[model samples]
Target: MQNNFIFFFYLLAFLLYIPTLILGTFLKPPTKKQISPPTPQSILARIKKGSKYTKQALEDFEKLFLNAQSCDQTLWLEIIKEFALSPSLEIKEITSLQEKLKQNNPNLQNEIALTISVAIKERK
Candidate 1:
């Protein structure tokens, strides 16, 4: 009787431990992968490919603004101008770009606003 009781106790512990291990394997949260931001050259390449102005492009452009302090001012200005003047962009899309510019770099807002206005006029 004593042997039987000990065996059943060990059996119960084993059963519980197995379920705990399985649950732990399944319930563990996934690790997030870190993705690097797009570079100016990459964005320019995308533009050169004649891809339409898109939300993803705008997001990548914003990333450039976030790193603007480390980038060449003149180069970024030219890139912004070129991006704003994209033939594929509609007036509304230009407006969205303007908003993004303002949000990312207020110092350049006025210049970009002017560029966006000119681009809108040219589109009309």
Candidate 2:
């Protein structure tokens, strides 16, 4: 009877251990997915989709520019040029928006200047 009891205990242990071992072999650990930062083109596209420079679009652009991620100056210039050339805005409105942009981002002075110059050249 003691031998039978011992056999039952071993059998129960084996049953539990075998299933765990099988599951461990089949299961895999979860992998982390890397999320990429926003691109200048995507931001520009969002701006272009709007009828005018909405507050949300400007905020998004500002966040992208201020982010530590490096982006091409040409793409930034293109976005500024697009903003400057938007038909819905008058010259005064454009200048006002430019001032607002400059005030918010002092580092963008040079790029804003270049964009204005390019817009002038394009207009002529």
Candidate 3:
């Protein structure tokens, strides 16, 4: 009876172990998928894609600038809007660029100076 009990326990252990051994033998380990980084062209394309939205915002700003009754406040508003909507640049960098443009080109028109600053910053 004790021998029979031991046989039953061994049989149960074998039943559990055999399937796992068979599966381990038959199944391949999972491989890591290699993800390629974006090429410069692809990165540029994505930046361009996002720029469409920026362009639309700029167009709206242009319309607002054209129609504004108060140029002083409106120019500031447009500058703020441009900085706000600019793609992915750090705020401090944009601010510094704007300040440098303003200091260097004090005689330039506000809109033109802002346009130059934004163009320079966004390309980075």
| lDDT (Cα) of model 3 | 0.54
RMSD of each: 5.3, 5.6, 13.9
Worst window of 10 by summed lDDT in candidate 1: 49-58
Give a tens-digit lDDT track for model 1, residues 1-124: 9999999999999999999999998897888999887777667666666746444665777765643465776766666666776777666777776787678777877777787677566656
lDDT of 3 by residue, 7-121 (tens): 9999999999999999999999999999764332333344346655444444443344333232454454445445444665455655664565456445544764566456655
In model 3, pairs of residues that clash are none
* Cα error, candidate 2, residue 17 (Å): 2.3
TM-score of each: 0.54, 0.51, 0.33
Give all candidates' CA lDDT scores: 0.70, 0.70, 0.54
Which structure is stronger by lDDT: 1 or 2? 1
Error of 3 at 67 (Å): 37
Worst 10 residues of 3 by lDDT: 61-70
Candidate 2 shows a clash count of 0
